[model samples]
Target: MNKIATIDTRLWQLGIMAILLLLGVLKRDFSLLPSQIALTFISGLLTQTLFIKFLNIKKYSFLSTIITCFGLCLLLRSANLWVHPVVAYLAIASKFTLRPFGKHLFNPANLGVILGISFFPETWITSGQWGADLTTALWLIAAGFFVARNAQRLDITAYFLMCYAGIFIIIRILWYGYPLAVFFHQFQNGALLLFAFFMISDPMTIPHKRIGRFIHAILVAVLAYIWQYWLYWNQGIIWGLFFATFLVPLWNILFLAPAYQWQPLSGDSNV
Candidate 1:
């Protein structure tokens, strides 16, 4: 048998996302057609391939493209079939156009989702679409944790979740006298958990240094809380991450670390 060590973190992420997509479609009414999913992958991969060829860049990988497509499928909602493919194309295109210091500036799926909702008001994300089921939330947390661990970015996810939860507890329960159950109930949100683990934890877009990642996580959490609670805006987490990404280049300059690679180096495990 082949050694399990040969697998890439991207492969693990792809498997986990595939399972989540299947579960969402089969059980949660994900509001996407099979054809739409197919179109997303096809368009995303094709865009990546064309960009690689057009730029004459050798040794390009499609793993990121696949992950972006799955993310878009999981988060983005649309009334037309063209929206998925178009967004997928634009997402992949940004990887090439938006690079600063040889790294992609924004998380591809996050940018795509933000642009989709911003430009096309009809296209929106359903944060509670997966329903607040304890069993499902637990499963997502476990699976997402495993994936984040494999990717060597679990610290950011942990910090973000803790900080975000702390803000909610302090404001909603203690400051406002809301019931403690309300604090616990917030954990049942599948979208919030998914965003914490999958979207914001993307290794490529995040800062390379540990301190940078932690500071970035705290900034995102605080911004998300203010946007959602204080400003009465929806999808605060998504918008928070989007805005915080603009500072990534500055972080990289101040605290430099090696860029993350999905494929493991010769004897190293973490990438």
Candidate 2:
């Protein structure tokens, strides 16, 4: 396979931008395009300089900018809040401020959402938590499966989902009366599916080893469930991802160190 086609780092980004746009359109959050475009340009420029470092046609840059705009639109629409452009600028700026070398500790969008929700209460921002209906839940589940397959992380996803569901179920059985409808509603609500598939699976920030990834993913799931149901934390996914981002990398390093120091077996050589 040609490396360029397969390894064009921008392709996944482009795909994600398109996804964000489609989400915006479906949810009718067209107004956020400008900010999304601006953010996309910054993301592209920084990612290209650090990772791909490739110079493409001018049109590509333009399209990339548009992608950011569309994403911002989706984000703002989803939030259903009225944050100013300055706030958006601050959110994007924080991405760089929070990570000096551009290795973001958490998803920028997740961070921005949480910051907006927590510190900027005056912004009047509400997430399109409204768009989170039964149909969207079904779609999110399908997308989650596909994303997990692409990342070769279906095992992790399964472990995480099972842990989350199991904990919630046990909690209901043991303490709270499990309202079946609300229980299911939680799964189908907000951008939980999006976080599970896309944000949580960011390769740069997640564990690489199979076992490590599984354990890390399970932890994320358990933590997410606790935050959402037990704590009633609104930005539950962000909290989960933020912790997973730091902890999973450490877990991978610790687990892999033992293997790295061990000599390979006579017949079975593996890292």
Candidate 3:
């Protein structure tokens, strides 16, 4: 196979997520506990394995579980240890159970974040885990853009960023008296970059067609803006993606395309 088709993009995701977790723990003073991290992986792995066996699904693989575990460790913070494992379990379980139109409706990590924040009072998301440092922001954008490019989902990432930044500029900057620096500062947020590159770029959950992906990105941006700006709520992006997930089936219906499937690398037997 050509090098492009030989690459496993999920490996890049895992490596980057591991780096983020390490950075958060060592530099950002994240509240993520060791026990929580351990349990999160164990729960996700076991859940994925069980579902694969019982459901007779030979198509799914373990990289998605590992990626989800890393995402949980990076984005989720909880005072309670059990919250991590439970959310991890449900997130993986949702992949098997929540298939609408033969495709998973929500990104597993995204769903895990939603569950943690919604069901557990002590759980929360930490944008500060990656921090607003200039170097860090640049690194995040560069790394994420590279990953999205390799996965051929750079269009969706670009569209989402453009729509989100445009909304901020037109409404919050040009319309109001806010400085352009404010816009730049908000883009420095790590959570937004992570969501754009990793969660939304997942081939399994997003739309299969180009136009559908474009519209989906717009929906996510608009819904997130409504939640944060109009409704006066925090973590709008997370909730925005959650509500937007319901319409994925609609996108598939309107667009009439096959669901995305991972193209396994050459000389690799796992499917």
Candidate 4:
């Protein structure tokens, strides 16, 4: 019997994200022009290539760079063309420069989005851009499930979602006496689902051990809840993840596990 082939999880994620980007652009009006998207890919890949050559890394994998570009296309918005490429370049650059204990400190796409929004006021994420439609929410959840499952970090996604939802229920529905519809409305945000599944569930940035991942997920949920609800802030998940990243090294120290590699046994396994 011929053995079935396994697709690289990064490719699976890339395909899924590409579909999401197409849907966002076609149906949701994601506010990005084709030129901007093209520029982002060009700059990101070019930067990745330069880094690999400069650093003398033997393995050349563009999957992560493509994935990061897709993420930037989906989540980031800016009026200027330069903004996308600059952010993309910085995002890829962080992966090389920000390593500690043999691992990248921040999720590339997350870091890019956070930095874009922070440095340039015009660039921001539209959490509700996908709308409150149940159909859209279901579509994201289904696609995200496969990606998370393939990455073997579905547990982190589940824990984060459950904790985030639990906090929403207690604070908004029960304590504040908001209508059930309000809770459901918030639950159906496509951006929230995207963050939970794609961004936070990134194996490279997440804790290696199961227990550490669980704790990390819960911490992000609580911090995000407080940031969005109590502090009346926008892009709560992005900021929450940013601040929570400070604790990841600590978690790794407390509970050691092998660093994640996109492809095992490859010469260039780090990507």
In order of listing, the candidates' clash counts read 0, 11, 0, 0
Candidate 1: where are CA atoms >4 Å away?
Answer: 1-6, 265-271
lDDT of 2 at 15: 69
lDDT of 1 at 35: 96
TM-score of 4: 0.95
Model 2, stretches more than 4 Å misplaced? 1-17, 26-104, 115-130, 257-271
Ordered from best to worst TM-score, the candidate numbers read: 4, 3, 1, 2
TM per prediction: 0.94, 0.65, 0.95, 0.95
The TM-score between candidate 1 and the true structure equals: 0.94
| Candidates 1 and 3, the one with greater lDDT | 1
Better of 1 and 2 by TM-score: 1
Q: State the lDDT at 229 in candidate 3.
A: 90
| Candidate 2 residue 83 C-alpha distance from true site, Å | 7.2
lDDT of 1 by residue, 1-271 (tens): 1344356767877898999999999989889999999999999999988988898876667777888999999999999888999999999899999887877898999999999998975698999887887998899999887777666766899999999999999889999999998876888899999999888988888999999999899999999998999999999999999999999889889998888766652233111
Which ranges in model 3 have alpha carbons more than 4 Å from their true place?
1-5, 266-271
lDDT of 3 by residue, 25-63 (tens): 888889888899999999999998898789786556688
Candidate 3 has a TM-score of: 0.95
